[model samples]
Target: MTRKIIAMAATVICVLGGFTASASSVAQDNPTVKEVKLRAEFYQNELDLLLDKARRGNFADFYQDVVKFAHYGEKYPQYLLGVMLLKGDGVQQDIGQGLVWIRLALEQKNTEWQKVYDSITAKLTKEQLDALEPMYETYKARFGVQAQKMSCNNEKMEASNIRIHQCRKTLVLKEFYSVYEYN
Candidate 1:
């Protein structure tokens, strides 16, 4: 049972995008880590699966999740948000918004997505690009992100190890970029 639980937790962590330095160095508490781990599980099974559903040609569902995921600060969703908005896939065509989303995606990681960025840029005029500045600032402000501890309440963390828990959250004081949360 213990081995099984450890394996399950490890799998969930993989699905949650794995451990981060911030998650490890932030806090040293079992309860907090447990909750955050639950949040990660939720993120993987729910949000990640939603993206898969969208890929199967569910635009309406895809668009809905995209709106919520826009605030989640992950690369793939941000990229998708950009592409869909740019091409008017389901949401209204908004080149400026597309640029913002794609750019935000780029900021998340250095990936092989330059082509997408290039394709979008190729079509924009200098004037349009210039005009995008104001809106871009607004988008950037909203989309700006930093590493944050995934959170859950005490009840949620009952399964976590104290050592594991300590390495799972930020210990120092922080004004986090985003917290994985559901209402």
Candidate 2:
């Protein structure tokens, strides 16, 4: 009886260990790193276009880019879309939706988003800001969690231009000139 009990225990341990190893191997094979890298690359491309439109003061082009990329569910694109709406840059002004995206961006901890937020907020009256408070609170309650806050101050226009140039270089290296192929 003692020998039977020891054999049963050993069999259970071996089965569990095998299961765990298999599970770990499967997870390793399906690594999320490639998906994440692709998303980052896509985002960088969109950001490059946005920076170009912004530098040229072509809000219409910028607005189109915002709508096109916002479909990807990327936080930065959403934030920029909100900024465009809030400032009436390329679309009909809608403060409520704009604030929603701003809050979402904040929740995502995209610090660079703060620059667009600040720019729009500076244009709004105190009454407007007050009106947005409740909506902001609701959004916060739903999705707000502590995230690393990002700052936009001391970010010079020159720095953004440099980034644009770098992005262009990357695109050239990748053999992609236009984000939208003129076919």
Winner by lDDT? 1
Q: lDDT (CA) for every model shown?
A: 0.51, 0.46
How does residue 73 of candidate 1 score in lDDT?
Answer: 51
Residue 162, model 2, lDDT: 30
Clashes of each: 9, 0
* Backbone clashes counted, model 1: 9
TM-scores, all candidates, are: 0.56, 0.39
Candidate 1 local Cα displacement, residue 151, angstroms: 16
* Least accurate 10 contiguous residues by lDDT in model 1: 163-172
The number of the candidate with the highest TM-score is 1
Measured with C-alpha atoms, the lDDT of residue 171 in candidate 2 is: 32
Cα error, residue 165 of model 1, in Å, equals 25
What is the per-residue lDDT of model 1 for residues 108-131, given as tens digits with 9 covering 90 to 100? 443345655655455555765676
Model 2 alpha-carbon drift over 4 Å, by segment: 1-46, 110-183
Clashing pairs in 1: 24-167, 26-169, 26-170, 26-171, 27-169, 27-170, 27-171, 28-166, 34-157
The residue-by-residue lDDT of candidate 2 on 75-97, one tens digit each, is: 56566666665556678755556
